[model samples]
Target: MADNILRIAIQKSGRLSEDSLKLIKECGIRFDNGAGKLKTNATNFPAEILFLRDDDIPGYVEDGVAHLGIVGENVSEESARDVDTVHKLGFSRCRLSIGVLREHDYQGVSDLQGKSIATTYPRLLGQYLEANGVNAAIHEISGSVEIAPSIGLADAVCDIVSSGSTLLSNGLKEVETIFRSEAVMIASKHLSDTQKTLLDQLLFRIKSVQAAKN
Candidate 1:
């Protein structure tokens, strides 16, 4: 909570977690991350790292509980928090897609009219549906969205698609991509002058690391 130190939130465990940690180390920020530790202080940089649920990262940054966060763009937009997406990490790339039963005569998004779609991302799904002028019922569920169709829980599903293997295994076929997502750095709007300067330095290092890969 010090004005001079930046508090960066990241997913504790998920596809983005390792990439986030690697980026920080690449930025020359050293810290002891003991196993199961929820938080750690950077030994070289004026920052602290808070490991949290990916879905909660944006809200923590928006509330200034953490000065910054790295999360998927899908989660950020779905959370609808008032945090600034300062940079795109360009990793943990995936898409939010709509899928239907493989046996169904799937034609297009228009075929979803009046049908119920299960998803963890109701907001994003709703937006995509509205933009396409398609009307459907959105059933928000916490997890196991892909199995919705099999159990008769819903007619279709809106979920994250990485390699499309999961969908195929679940007897569903991806029909439409609603959102493309990758890891992104988000900053709190209430950063102090000192914190902002430190963030700039950290970003400089990150960019340098990224440049070296080319």
Candidate 2:
């Protein structure tokens, strides 16, 4: 037998995980979210929560494995999954910015021509560079993008910036903001009638909680 309860995916760890759990708790969905659990069934609501990497949430929802997901917009956009964003929760705010060594004499994006860049988001970086008509070698790296310039791996780097602290520590300065992002709620494109009704109920609760916070 299959469970009819809705499944929601959230970040296993990182900036979005704690807040995602808080949102579910605020929505009155009581569940045992002990440490190290991958999935949990709600005791008071007809929902199941799955903890996973934020990067994987978009695909999971798009594939209908999860009915809903909470993830950062940076990930959602970069992944380009077919899921729909139902709500933009005003938290985990950040921006994807182009950073260079603090000593670089950068006047504008044009200065990046023919320069090597390191980033995890190659697609997003490529689109921005193409739109600006700047040609730069993109060195795709999974993490520690800020260290690229220091290690002679790249002339500039594109990465997420919240407070500019990480870049500062790496002797880099943010020169341009290419993308702004925050936590958002995404849903599967296809939903059954029953699933839609349940989704409506969940949305109502989320809206109510958000309204109360404001």
Please, what is the whole-model Cα lDDT of each candidate in the order they appear? 0.95, 0.93
Candidate 2 root-mean-square deviation in Å: 1.1
Stretches off by above 4 angstroms in model 2 are 1-3
Cα error, candidate 1, residue 34 (Å)? 0.4
lDDT of prediction 1: 0.95
Which stretches of model 1 miss by more than 4 angstroms?
Answer: none
lDDT of 2 at 46: 83
Per-residue CA lDDT of candidate 1, range 163-212, in tens? 88989999999999999999999999999999999889988888898899
- How many Å off is the CA of 116 in candidate 1? 0.5
Cα lDDT tens digits, model 2, 39-124, are 99999988899999888999999999999999999999999899999999999999999999999988999999999999999989
For each candidate, what TM-score against the reference? Answer: 0.99, 0.97
